[model samples]
Target: MTLGIDVVRAAPKVLLHDHLDGGLRPQTIAELAAGIGHELPVADPAGLGGWFAEAADSGSLERYLETFEHTVAVMQSAEALTRVARECVEDLAADGVVYAEIRYAPEQHVSAGLTLDEVVAAVQQGFDEASASGGIVVRQLLTAMRHQARSREIAELAVAWRDRGVAGFDIAGAEAGNPPTRHLDAFEYLQRENAHFTIHAGEAFGLPSIWQALQWCGADRLGHGVRIVDDITVHPDGTAELGRLAAYVRDKRIPLEMCPASNVQTGAADSIAEHPIGLLTRLGFRVTVNTDNRLMSNTSMSKEMHALCEAFDYGLADLRWFTINAMKSAFLPFDQRLALINDVIKPGYDKF
Candidate 1:
């Protein structure tokens, strides 16, 4: 039997889809904006929160992304990046996230005159400081912008910081016009270096993007792979049929970093009540729940799990599976990942 919502909220969670730039504290944004003299859509924290939610609910990824202008505007300095990263750890720890990998494109933060190496160092320092004080273990995923031609540089950057704090690499931003294959050189380089990377695919785009990411670009995982559902077919007898790509993904246990609230906001799904998370979970797709953006989507790991339970009637067993799935998909080493599952995740699930 499943415990109540409180028990669920207290369950140890693993997050893989959180963005470093997207989960900024509203107060931090206001303070950073003030320091940089950048104008904001809203000043008060309460109003700023509402502004982000409302702006992101526009149902168009392009329009929804316009909101990041204000966020990225203030994250130009080392001090600002460090503060945001530290706060991200503190907030995730409070939400019962035991392990999280936060992703951000370093090139975006360089417009304010900081070097790419400086941007990575500042965020890494903040993560180290926050983890020293907090109970959560936070890792960084250095991201390359898909629209730009800097994936190889970002991949090298992630490798350069592998010993510091960066756990892996990723390609983010508008996945429509730009495909992961555009950065094949970067993925090839990372492959040669024996590095890990996840590609943002099948969110706003369809399966071709996903196919290329996995087959051509060789992504270790898929971000917002909600569209993989397109490859599945339901028969009159209610048995599910998986297309070749879907079956390969399932057979290989490639992780799908599904962010339900963010998916709904970006029109990846119609609504929370009608998301494919339940279907994907039932089909054993190695689905893991996450908060893509805390400020923009106004979400956390606890809130995201609670919403999943409400949407799919999930219980402790289902929640535990999600936790294990995330731990399996994390870029951490195998022994450490198993230790976390045995010592932390399973014990919490048993308590519930």
Candidate 2:
């Protein structure tokens, strides 16, 4: 059941919770910044990448959140947005990702004079261009920052672009003070329209955050639900028992977009071996692996899968299980999900 990194990289994968702004190539960031006359703390591309990875490992919620300031600062125009979006697809496709849902906050990209719709169009243009020649299937998830009050605006955008390229909606940011309930109107509207949405909960906060996201906001999935690990109890005999919240999550089949490297970098866990995903996956909680921020975490879907396989001694079947879990939880239509799993993922992995 042991696997190598090369074999893992060659295996087909699915990613459900990657951030568009968080996955930019360092060289691309430098080029964009130079064109806009933006000053960067680290001008060299390799050094800049290392800076983000090192800076993100601060383990403090406030400090970790600050790393996005530079990345978002450079991505304020259509050219920067399109280039970042295009590179996101190319990078993931090179890492063997067959399907992915990339999320980004439109409200943050309005510094130079681009409207919310224009930002979406620019990113969509990049994805369409990538899809024309690549083998990867990429979709968009319109994200509204939880600290901001623009969820309704972003939610409506997702609904409007349902037929275009956007697949769903999400609200992400610091989860401690800004709970998902603050965006009740947006969640309510999405629910009424039967539109899909996920909430960022239980990453920096605890069970109360998760309770509000699901019980109050009606989230279809949990973004970084690592804190749900607090509800379960593990005994000396090696047996584990799920608390009420954990039981409900499992019973309802709610997908957990568990990001291993990002969680460790953000202090959600002490290490990957200590990550609750090991036990959560064993207990069957509809768990799926993710690269929360590719730049900050220095990770890819293939690397995430390889890390888990090394940590858990997983093989081809375990990798397949996680890939299928993500594919099932994709916001893409059921027929399309089925086609990718049956036609692409299965056949691709069959070679090894």
Candidate 3:
């Protein structure tokens, strides 16, 4: 027998690909907006969040990115950054997320005359405080905007803060026209320094975008690689065919940070029922469930797992596979990872 949605909600989870800016409390956004005298799309929390989700539905990646203006606007100060980061961890902890890696662009917070280091320090401080209070382990991923030409500086910032709370580097924003390869210099520097980086590819775009990120830029993971399914085919006889890129990705065991609800909202998949998570899981691909943006998608790790369970009939064992896969793909030290597996993950699964 296997536990269902009620049990899954209590199960501990590991989260990757969650953005700090994208996960702010709707109430916090409104409060911050008021403090800064910035006008929001909606005055109320529920309506404000709906506006973000609606604006992000634009098929074009550039258009989808326009919604970030509101999030980034309120995050211009260190105090705001710290408060939001702390609350984000608290919220996840209450929702049963044990470990999480949150990413944000440092450059986006400098409008308040704060240096990049100040921004990183503020968010790290927030994570530290939240961890103390909530007992949740949180790490940071510093991101560089692909359209911006300052990736090298952002990479350096990530490396500088790695000893603190920063865990890795990532490229975000408008992944269609601006591929990860455009930031080759930053990727080369990170590679030379042995830093881990994941790229946003194959989400709103297709396979060519994924190929460029992995083949040219050497990404450690694929952020929203949902569109990599394009490289796969199935014959009338029920035999699956894998194209070269798909085969390479599968063989390499590169993690796919799949955000099911976000994928549907962005048209990456037709619906959660038809999502390739079920297909890829059966094929042994390293698939991890994530809530790309809790506010924008109105989701959490629990909701994502519940959705998968209902959509694919996943049970306790299947949920265990997702958790272990996420732990394996997490950018944590070997000892800590094993400890989490043995101490936290296994015990939670047993209870379910």
Candidate 4:
């Protein structure tokens, strides 16, 4: 059966890759920017929202990333950070996201004199307040800009806050010049401390980026590893072959945090119909759907699932599989993951 958008929105979902900075409400950005005297490209909330979505659809990774200047500018204060973070949880919960790992770079929020630790504390405060009401469980993933030199510091910060709402660490930015291996020291430190991290690779770049992220940095998961499809070839007779890297990824069950809308916006894939997700899912890769940037992509978990259903003719079972895959790949404890799957995700899907 074809799932309607309403049904998809009502289904419980899990998101592994969402950017906190990229998901701010346009109205909130206008308000915060006004408070801080920061001038936006568009003053009207609706216009600003449209501006972000349009500007991000530029088909260039670097150009797409340029939309963040306004969102990041307004988020420099503790009050703004807390408000955005709190609203993020509330919004996700309302959209049927039962679990999520929201990531943002702490260093980016420290420009207004807040320290990295203070920034994390502020964001966590917001998450804790919203999570206290209880429909959703949310955690933070501290990200370090791949073009910067503070990854080791961010990794340590994630470790320090591991017990308090922070789940993992990540590195993200334009992937052309900034390879994941550049932060080897940070990844090594995370490994020694038994911390988890996912690297942004294979989105703008290709197979070598994925190979280096897995083999060199020892990433726990791959962020937008869409280009891994480069290693697989389909024959005219309908047979397919996998290169060593593709075979290893599937064999190891490495989770690919696939963000369809964001991928299309960044020119990672031509369109949803042509996305690599269909082939990867058919071939048994650990594919999990996500909204890499909600404001930028103008998407939510429900919208992403609905799009996949439309494109691949997926039903509730397929949606359930994606949800289960995401939960299994989460940075949460194994026992906790099992409980959510059995008590929350499975039972939730069974009702449909």
Evaluation by lDDT, superior candidate among 3 and 4: 4
After TM-score superposition, the amount by which residue 291's alpha carbon in candidate 4 deviates from its true location, in angstroms, is: 0.3
The clash numbers for all candidates, in the given order, read 0, 0, 0, 0
lDDT of 2 at 288: 90
37-129: candidate 3 lDDT, tens digit per residue? 989878998888887777777566565666678888999998999999999999999888888999998999999899999999999989999
Q: Specify the highest-lDDT model's number.
A: 4
TM-score winner between candidates 2 and 3: 2
lDDT of 1 by residue, 124-163 (tens): 8888888897567889999999999999999999999998
Per-residue lDDT value at 330 in model 2: 92
The TM-score values for the models, in the order shown, are 0.97, 0.98, 0.95, 0.98
Order the candidates by TM-score, highest first. Answer: 4, 2, 1, 3
Q: Using lDDT as the measure, name the better of candidate 2 and candidate 3.
A: 2
The models' CA-based lDDT, in order, is 0.90, 0.90, 0.89, 0.94
lDDT of 1 at 256: 96
Best of the candidates, TM-score = 4
Model 2 per-residue lDDT tens digits across residues 177-215: 898889999999999988999888999899999999999
In model 1, what lDDT does residue 226 have?
Answer: 92
lDDT for position 213 in model 2: 94
